[model samples]
Target: MERYVLTVTLNAAVDVAYTVPGFSPGGIHVAAAVRRVAGGKGNNVARVLARLGVRVAATGFAGGAAGRFIQDELRRAGVVPEYVEVAGESRTCYAFTDPETGVVTELRERGPELGPEDVARFKARYDRLLAGAELVTISGSVPPGVEPEIYRYLIERARSCQVRVVLDSSGQPLREALVARPYVVKPNRAELAGWAGRPLETEADVLEAARRMRTAGPEWVLVSLGADGALLVGPDGAGAWRAVPPQVAALNPVGSGDSAVAGLACGLVRGLGPEELLRQAVACGTANARTAGVADVDPAEVERLARRVRVEPV
Candidate 1:
């Protein structure tokens, strides 16, 4: 059976997280809480998708105890990860979520340095996986020694297999991938700004900037705005809209983008249009905001948020 989705997490890691109340520069309060678990961009995405009853396979690199730990954690989460044992151990990402203010501060790793052989090995694995995937999401930054053109390379490879590729990266890596024209590319405001070589100041600016990017080739370009919502540009339709978060206060803001990806990917795999895509995308994002780190959003909550999503097709 052809898999519905395949997620590529090149710079994979085991995320060790914690939380504390009333953080201060030099002192700490007596009361607090802490939690640690496995995490990575694609892993986070797959976790949400699987929890939503979407079958997924997480593919990338891993090594050492940290790598084993992340692999173990993913398996425990019921996520099937095909992790290649790279030369070094997996990296760690730390997040401190403050309950009172709903602020999350993250300390991220630079990630593993891949040799040419390591890159070749991962590429082979990616090729094998693409054969079974209907949609593929290749996200995160480029690791050490990895070429900036890796996204372009992978996007081209996946497309050759008829796999819909989504690129969610920034800087040189994203700029390079534009040349290959993945099926979809999600760049938040700042990232789209850099890619446009200017400041994306207004809704018009965002729409126009994305238009210029079409010359670089993605079929759909989605630009996400925190709380404000996202703009979609491409074959299905072009639109601008705002997301109205549910009445409840936001608990945390982590993994919101990945949630959007899962929602949109799910719709795409089922042949849904942009209205449906953005509807689910908005709901997923709001659902993410209502939870702690990596914990799933309730489907019923997503349904609630979905009802509030307003899409203005342009």
Candidate 2:
């Protein structure tokens, strides 16, 4: 079997998006467009990875009609689905976009709860998948009945297999996984601030917070700054770089972060230098923002934007 990048989305969902022109509270408005697809942070990353010509597989829990939709969608997107079906139905998350105001309101549902058996089944499947995985990416929230320590266990297993892991999550799961020392941790500004227990107001503040996070366990801390671009702090703490992407008229910023994660994974697999890696990550993110669909980006656009990205040592 060929080694491929593995993406884990524990609480996978069917993402529904509605374009409502004059979206307001307590008002009747006809949606201009409605789109639904398989979505979770990891699934979004998988979609972008496939689009980038990477061999990728997605695993998580899925059930009922929504789960079927998710599996079919992944197949359509050129990603192999390796989900474990549960007794409960998978969730469907809704996002309402107001084109007039350029604002998006989201309503997300907590997916099905997992039992001990379900967890055991998933672990067994994950163990088998890890054998043929060059790298692993775990993203998004866990469903009810699953402990935060699950991420830690997964990271440990992947490490035991000598596979690098890129973790994109928040709260307790993020905190727990850090102890496993994943290769990379990608957190948005707000997520980093939450982990830091303080507000990061300036560039220096953000950099300092990222350094502190590095001490926890992760080899590299990539702090995503919406609009301003991203900051990458290396393992040694001495090497740091800031990537500023070329400005574009952003149509939707929903899954830009996941696209960035996909870019980082691709860079890692390709053995890119730090500067080039940051450029690719920022370019993918910026390109995703140009489209309304989540993680939908053109490779040509990404290449063009990568050339314009400015990366400098900090």
Candidate 3:
């Protein structure tokens, strides 16, 4: 049996991206280009992992025509889709990008609600997948009708199987999952600040907040700072490092964090050290930002960017 990474996106979506030259509110404009793919935080992570030659399987609730599209897209991308079908229709999220201003505006719909039956079916599938999974990534929001404690339950199950989990979420779900002590937790600067209930105004502030989160159970805390890069707090808060990328023009910043999570999972499975891990993670993020589509990174670009990433102990 091949070992693989398992990614869960409970509220999976068909992501649609449109490029408009001068996108402005309240005006009808023609799009220069359009792209659609399977998305949601975990799905993006799965896609990136597959691009990097990692065997990855994606699971969660998928329904309706949109859901079928997502499955087909993932299969075409070399990611195995094992989503549990639900009754409700999956959502379609839209992102409008203005190339002239380098701005992206997004509108996301709350996807199909999952009932107790749906959750039960998913858990059964998840448990079977965990058997072959080297790592698990749980990302994105909890859909309606599912309890926020869902993440906690999932983490506990993964832990029971002795599988390391990489969690990426915010708000109530994040708070609940932290108690389970995931192997890695990736939060953006704003998400960390929200959890800390205080403004993280400086590097020291961010570091302190990340350390505080470590006490909750995670072995590693990674806080992503757009442009400035990411901060990594090691196990037991023994060491902290900041990985900064060389500046590059960003075409789209959406899903960059998911790409970073993919990189982190890859590094962990490869047994990379702290510095190299951060370097690869930051490079994946930076490479994602340079692409017009979400989580679409060139392997050569990722390798090139990794060499330029400066990982400094903080």
Candidate 4:
């Protein structure tokens, strides 16, 4: 009776975040503070779920000492891992935040090299984990040479095992996963734009693009537009964007979407209706934006924002 959700991360990493005073390239400066956290799209989603009191089993590939640090960090955050060990060192993704300008610059690595045997082993572990999972969430980037259809592969397997699949990925993986069609897929602004082959400059554009993404494969789509809010499009057909409101005092935009995805998964687990889920998702996102470097979303804020989350027709 292990009731848990599985979060799969293919391009997992150790996230290092630091803030410095006003910064300019080649300027001598003193570092303000630095923190390292276990990170990956799926891992972050798991963290949000755990913070919300949901049981999660994170499954992903990890390598070397850095990978071990990632696993240890997840444990501290109450997210137990079912990690598959690999040969190379895990990659590190850094965030350089400047308080003066209120800007964050991201430097991402291509991630460690994953071999075919390593891939097979990861799949085997995934299959084992899926047997006991209520929901399977595939998130983050699919590394080079790992077929874009990997998302499709996982979704198909999850379907075969009668578990609902939740996907949060972008680029070709998003395109490929559409064929197998997971239960839920969350895409952000730029990601949705690429799927539509046009920029989503307006709310109407986001709604249309979400539907287009739906046609590609996922049963339900939640399109996220930072600061502005998020939209839900599905068989539930509840399309609405919860505006952040003009004067909410927004902060870091990072991890908000992942928090929203975690909210949707939690909602699905609770069998909530479309409107309730949408509101909760927005609450989680808005709360995350208010948090500093860490992705720990304030539960109290989610509740407060949930009441004001505006959902309008597309």
Candidate 5:
């Protein structure tokens, strides 16, 4: 039987993007174009997975009008919405982009706090979804009042069902979840550096840090390096590979990381080899950077870029 990939976003939002000619702090600026959509790391991942023709379902805490908008938008984009409702309203986020500089500044609101009752409800729903999930990608920040241990609990639950899990998070949450030993942990260079509590200055430093992280729990540590592509370190820290992406002038990079997560999930479901998986992951990230909207990737563009991705074992 074919299984689907399930994506979880604890703190969801309605994302509004505005494009401006240029930005100046403390100066009035007008938007040239505006677009609004449902957003959260897992939600974006689910959207990209759907675009790639993967079977995907998005779940998490959602409430109020903003939550309804998120559900409608995800349905419109062909992603299955399986969110658990709460009492408080969902959050909103705004991204301001400067066309000339390709710089984006984000203004985000903290989502509603989750009560004990809310947590129990979500956990029940999540348990039901795990039965049909072959792979699970848990991404983004937890809402207020939610403990960092939430990731650990979810990871353990997925593992109990023999489901592979890809975790994308940072700070205390990432630190806590590492104990659960996720199947894969996807973090960017910056997040890795933060986890290390020191700046990673050289390639060797990055590789060493990833190796050390692998010792903690994750089977695979995939570190994203933006335009430079990504680095992958295997379970034993002996197998390592680097994937170089195709060059493209990026317009907006809001959801590129989440796009990469989707690509990784796709590769896993398709049973692709390590090298091929890294290549596809980088290609998807590159494709997302080529577009202005979050998770708005072109499948043809991804294929074109995939051909140019260079994957080499390190």
Candidate 6:
């Protein structure tokens, strides 16, 4: 039996995207097109991994009509859904895109609050799902009433099951989960700066911060720099590589980080080397940026971008 990669999104949402001729805040603008899809960081990652031909299962707390839409869309995208039902309606996120200027503005909702019963139920479901999972990726923020330590508990559980865990989160949850030592961690420049409690002003500063983080837990740390590309560091600072992606006109940068996380997770599961992994990760992110919508990347585009990516060891 093929072992599936499990993705966890504690706060799931229905993502609605609208394309307009141009965006003018506080002014009326007619939309050229509208689309709705399943969204959440992990859900986006699962979609990209599925596109890369990996078997994936997405699990999290969801409810109401929006939740149903999320599950249906995940199924349509070839990602198996195994969500736990909650009492409240799931949240909705709105993304407004300007095709002319390639600017996207998003209005995201804080998810519904979860109670003790909701947390307990989701934990029970997650434990059972771990039985068949080879790797687990936990992403996004936890809803209200959930402790920041929730990720720590889940990381410990995944370790007990002998499954690799990849974490992509920030702030308090990230601070707590670092103690559990996940296999990999993906944080953008801003997040890393927040964790370090100081602005990372240079490439050297970012690399140093990534090295400091590696000592706290995760075997690998990947720091994304948006158009500037990303920097990767391995366990104990034994290896380091930086990948600069090819410049392309970006359509929607909303879920590009999730796409990068998907690529890094894919490379890890396939046992790709550090350089190769960074290449693939950058390629996927670039492909995502070059296209519209979340995880709507083209495979051939990814392959072509991969060759154009410039990776250098630090």
* Whole-model lDDT, model 4: 0.83
Where does model 2 exceed 4 Å of error? none
lDDT per residue, candidate 2, 199-284, as tens digits? 99999999999999998999998998978999999978459999999889998888999999999999999999888889999999
Better of 2 and 6 by lDDT: 2
User: lDDT tens digits, residues 155-254, model 5?
Assistant: 9999999999999999999999999999999989999999999999988999999999989999999999999899999976359999998778999988
Q: List candidate 5 stretches off by more than 4 Å.
A: none
Clashes of 3: 0
Model-by-model lDDT, in order?
A: 0.79, 0.95, 0.95, 0.83, 0.94, 0.92
Model 2 lDDT at residue 172 = 98
Q: How many backbone clashes does candidate 6 have?
A: 0
lDDT tens digits by residue: candidate 3, 74-100: 999999999999997999999999999
What TM-score number comes out for model 5? 0.98
Worst 10 residues of 2 by lDDT: 232-241
C-alpha RMSD values across all candidates? 2.0, 0.8, 0.8, 1.7, 1.0, 1.1
Q: Please provide, for model 1 over 228-308, each residue's C-alpha lDDT reduced to its tens digit, 9 standing for 90 to 100.
A: 778888753454444444555777777888888877777788788777787888788778887875646677888888888
Q: Report how far residue 87 has shifted in candidate 1, in Å.
A: 2.0
- Candidate 1 segments whose C-alpha is farther than 4 A from its true place: 29-31, 236-247
Query: RMSD, model 6, all Cα superposed?
Result: 1.1
- Runs with alpha carbons beyond 4 Å of true place in candidate 6: none
lDDT of 6 at 136: 96
Please list the residue runs of candidate 3 whose C-alpha ends up more than 4 Å from where it truly belongs after superposition.
none
Candidate 3 lDDT at 99 equals 95
